[model samples]
Target: MPRYEYRCRSCGDTFELSRPMSESAAPAECPAGHADTVKLLSTVAVGGSSSAPAPSSGGGCCGGGCCG
Candidate 1:
Protein backbone atom coordinates (compact mmCIF):
# COMPACT_ATOMS: atom_id res chain seq x y z
CA MET A 1 0.00 0.00 0.00
CA PRO A 2 1.07 3.54 -0.73
CA ARG A 3 0.26 6.71 1.18
CA TYR A 4 -1.60 9.44 -0.64
CA GLU A 5 -2.02 13.06 0.39
CA TYR A 6 -5.16 15.10 -0.07
CA ARG A 7 -6.53 18.54 0.67
CA CYS A 8 -10.13 19.41 1.43
CA ARG A 9 -11.52 22.30 -0.53
CA SER A 10 -14.56 22.80 1.66
CA CYS A 11 -12.69 23.17 4.95
CA GLY A 12 -9.12 23.73 3.77
CA ASP A 13 -7.81 20.69 5.63
CA THR A 14 -5.10 18.26 4.60
CA PHE A 15 -4.81 14.54 5.31
CA GLU A 16 -3.19 11.32 4.19
CA LEU A 17 -4.56 7.87 3.41
CA SER A 18 -2.99 4.50 2.79
CA ARG A 19 -4.69 2.41 0.16
CA PRO A 20 -4.15 0.09 -2.77
CA MET A 21 -2.60 1.61 -5.88
CA SER A 22 -5.65 0.62 -7.87
CA GLU A 23 -7.71 3.04 -5.81
CA SER A 24 -5.06 5.71 -5.51
CA ALA A 25 -7.29 8.06 -7.50
CA ALA A 26 -10.37 7.40 -5.42
CA PRO A 27 -12.01 10.20 -3.53
CA ALA A 28 -11.18 10.64 0.13
CA GLU A 29 -12.95 12.33 3.02
CA CYS A 30 -11.12 14.93 5.01
CA PRO A 31 -10.57 14.63 8.77
CA ALA A 32 -13.02 17.46 9.26
CA GLY A 33 -15.64 15.46 7.32
CA HIS A 34 -15.36 17.49 4.14
CA ALA A 35 -16.13 15.55 0.94
CA ASP A 36 -14.82 18.05 -1.57
CA THR A 37 -11.22 16.97 -1.50
CA VAL A 38 -8.44 16.71 -4.07
CA LYS A 39 -5.38 14.56 -4.30
CA LEU A 40 -2.03 16.33 -4.06
CA LEU A 41 1.15 15.68 -5.99
CA SER A 42 3.61 14.15 -3.54
CA THR A 43 7.38 14.11 -3.64
CA VAL A 44 9.79 11.35 -2.70
CA ALA A 45 13.38 12.02 -1.69
CA VAL A 46 16.33 9.66 -1.95
CA GLY A 47 19.33 10.37 0.24
CA GLY A 48 22.54 8.67 1.26
CA SER A 49 25.09 8.78 4.05
CA SER A 50 26.54 12.06 5.33
CA SER A 51 29.85 11.04 3.81
CA ALA A 52 28.35 11.88 0.43
CA PRO A 53 29.54 15.05 -1.20
CA ALA A 54 27.64 18.12 -0.05
CA PRO A 55 25.90 20.45 -2.51
CA SER A 56 27.68 23.64 -3.63
CA SER A 57 27.06 26.39 -1.11
CA GLY A 58 26.97 29.00 -3.84
CA GLY A 59 25.02 27.39 -6.68
CA GLY A 60 24.26 30.61 -8.53
CA CYS A 61 25.57 31.43 -12.05
CA CYS A 62 29.06 32.27 -10.81
CA GLY A 63 28.46 30.92 -7.36
CA GLY A 64 26.69 33.27 -4.96
CA GLY A 65 30.03 34.44 -3.52
CA CYS A 66 31.27 35.83 -6.85
CA CYS A 67 28.10 37.92 -7.35
CA GLY A 68 28.20 39.19 -3.79
Candidate 2:
Protein backbone atom coordinates (compact mmCIF):
# COMPACT_ATOMS: atom_id res chain seq x y z
CA MET A 1 0.00 0.00 0.00
CA PRO A 2 1.08 3.59 -0.67
CA ARG A 3 0.58 6.55 1.64
CA TYR A 4 -0.74 9.80 0.22
CA GLU A 5 -0.67 13.31 1.70
CA TYR A 6 -3.55 15.72 1.17
CA ARG A 7 -4.24 19.39 1.80
CA CYS A 8 -7.62 21.07 1.99
CA ARG A 9 -7.76 24.13 -0.18
CA SER A 10 -10.86 25.48 1.50
CA CYS A 11 -9.88 25.12 5.15
CA GLY A 12 -6.12 24.46 4.91
CA ASP A 13 -6.46 21.06 6.60
CA THR A 14 -3.71 18.51 5.98
CA PHE A 15 -4.11 14.73 6.26
CA GLU A 16 -2.79 11.39 5.03
CA LEU A 17 -4.22 8.13 3.67
CA SER A 18 -2.86 4.66 2.97
CA ARG A 19 -4.01 2.86 -0.14
CA PRO A 20 -2.90 0.72 -3.03
CA MET A 21 -0.54 2.02 -5.72
CA SER A 22 -3.20 1.78 -8.42
CA GLU A 23 -5.83 3.47 -6.25
CA SER A 24 -7.56 6.68 -7.23
CA ALA A 25 -7.05 10.22 -5.93
CA ALA A 26 -8.83 12.16 -3.14
CA PRO A 27 -12.50 11.52 -2.42
CA ALA A 28 -15.12 13.50 -0.43
CA GLU A 29 -14.68 16.24 2.16
CA CYS A 30 -11.52 16.97 4.14
CA PRO A 31 -10.96 16.49 7.90
CA ALA A 32 -11.93 20.11 8.53
CA GLY A 33 -15.39 19.43 7.03
CA HIS A 34 -14.51 21.21 3.81
CA ALA A 35 -14.94 20.05 0.19
CA ASP A 36 -11.68 21.49 -1.08
CA THR A 37 -9.25 18.66 -0.52
CA VAL A 38 -6.31 18.87 -2.91
CA LYS A 39 -3.82 16.06 -3.37
CA LEU A 40 -0.22 17.21 -2.83
CA LEU A 41 2.29 15.11 -4.77
CA SER A 42 5.57 16.98 -4.33
CA THR A 43 6.01 16.10 -0.65
CA VAL A 44 4.91 12.48 -1.04
CA ALA A 45 7.44 10.02 0.43
CA VAL A 46 6.84 7.18 -2.02
CA GLY A 47 10.09 5.28 -1.53
CA GLY A 48 13.51 5.21 0.11
CA SER A 49 16.78 6.78 -0.99
CA SER A 50 18.92 4.85 -3.44
CA SER A 51 22.33 6.59 -3.24
CA ALA A 52 24.91 5.81 -0.57
CA PRO A 53 26.75 8.33 1.64
CA ALA A 54 30.19 9.68 0.72
CA PRO A 55 33.38 8.26 2.26
CA SER A 56 34.68 9.68 5.55
CA SER A 57 38.00 11.54 5.91
CA GLY A 58 39.05 9.89 9.19
CA GLY A 59 40.81 6.63 8.32
CA GLY A 60 44.03 4.63 8.99
CA CYS A 61 44.91 4.43 5.26
CA CYS A 62 46.67 7.83 5.59
CA GLY A 63 49.37 6.40 7.94
CA GLY A 64 47.63 6.74 11.33
CA GLY A 65 46.10 10.09 10.41
CA CYS A 66 42.82 9.17 12.02
CA CYS A 67 44.39 8.90 15.53
CA GLY A 68 46.52 12.00 15.17
Best by lDDT: 1
Give me the displacement of residue 33 in model 1, in angstroms: 1.2
- Predicted candidate 2 versus true structure: per-residue lDDT over 1-68, tens digit per residue: 77777788887878887877666463746776888787777433544565666556554446546544
Off by over 4 Å in 1: 45-68
Against the true structure, what is each candidate's TM-score?
Answer: 0.62, 0.54
- Residue lDDT tens for model 1, 1-68: 89999999998988999999999988899998889999988765233346656667778547767764
Clash counts for the predictions, in order: 0, 0
Question: For model 2, how big is the CA root-mean-square deviation?
Answer: 4.6
How big is the positional error of residue 28 in model 2, measured in Å on the Cα after superposition? Answer: 5.7
Off by over 4 Å in 2: 24-28, 42-53, 56-64
